[model samples]
Target: MTDRNLRHPSPSPDATTSIAAEAEGFLLAQEHRSAAHREAQTLCDALPWLTTAQAEDLTRYYVAHRLRLSRQLFEASLARAEELRREYEARYLRLRRDLLRRHGAWASVLLACAAGVSGALSTLAR
Candidate 1:
């Protein structure tokens, strides 16, 4: 086949302007997304009952549902983020509990040592 046909494969002419316009639209959409995410984070933080997963899912739902993009990838990404957030939260809570336990144990040991030293000094004075 000819080089032109080989390169493009399809007979459609290159739509540079159209591609650029679409790219511009995508950038605008991304900016809107960032703003929306910031708003969602604020709302989520204020409303402690709402999990991050729920906020993200709401964001994705609003974007996909309102924008009407047929792209399945965004929905999939939201679901994945929800799952990852759950796992991360579980690990964080476990780590926090472990750290607190260790801290309390160490504090008790220090207190006991202090008391023992004070008792010995008092006896020496007598």
Candidate 2:
């Protein structure tokens, strides 16, 4: 069976994580409720001849389809965001390694110069 673990698992169940999750859930619920009402209103405006019962049934199906489309779009966006993050992070690591290597070489050169200066000064003093 394929492993189901998240590539970047959520942070440990801390208070901040719990609170953020709750807030996001609340916002999504509110958005869904508002969207459903607005969609039903548009449908009613367009099809004024629909009977109340028929309108209600149609609204339900419309809302279901809208939800499915929303889910697909959200998943696609999330995947793209993850891909971008991975690319950016890899580039950052490569750049950081190059910087450290350059800095190390400069530091070694500076240390050698300093040591030579110290030896010459001591010999002159003697």
Candidate 3:
């Protein structure tokens, strides 16, 4: 491999998994946006009697409402994301600690058994 390839850091498996999840979210968002556009067009078509200026005013009002709702949605999504991250981190830490403790106990038992076997062999050699 080239020096550049060796030096370049690869994305973690977890990062790739998260990117796939994020792409799915974006796809869902696009579908929602398309549905909203169709609904707005249907409403405009149904209100044919409204003057152009009136329609413009109505669009403006709805846009403002959409902006407010979007802000609320953004905040909620951010909060949920942070909560999920915290939950995952806690679980990962717990598992890591448990594994370390188990391995340490296993190693200690193996070492004690080996010492006993060696001491017995030494006594026999005498």
Candidate 3 per-residue lDDT over residues 66-92, each given as its tens digit: 656766898899999999999999999
Best by TM-score: 2
lDDT of 1 by residue, 86-117 (tens): 99999999999999999999999999999999
User: Local error of candidate 1 at 100, Å?
Assistant: 0.5
Q: Considering lDDT, which of the candidate structures 2 and 3 is the better prediction for this target?
A: 2
Best by lDDT: 2
Task: Give TM per candidate.
Answer: 0.46, 0.75, 0.65
Worst 10-residue lDDT window for candidate 3 reads 32-41
lDDT of 2 by residue, 1-126 (tens): 235455645567796789998999789967986797698779877998999989888888888888788789889999999999999999999999999999999999999999999999999999
What's the lDDT of the predicted structure labeled candidate 1?
0.78
lDDT of each: 0.78, 0.87, 0.82
Q: Which segments of model 3 are wrong by more than 4 Å?
A: 1-39
lDDT at position 15, candidate 2: 67
Model 2 TM-score?
Answer: 0.75
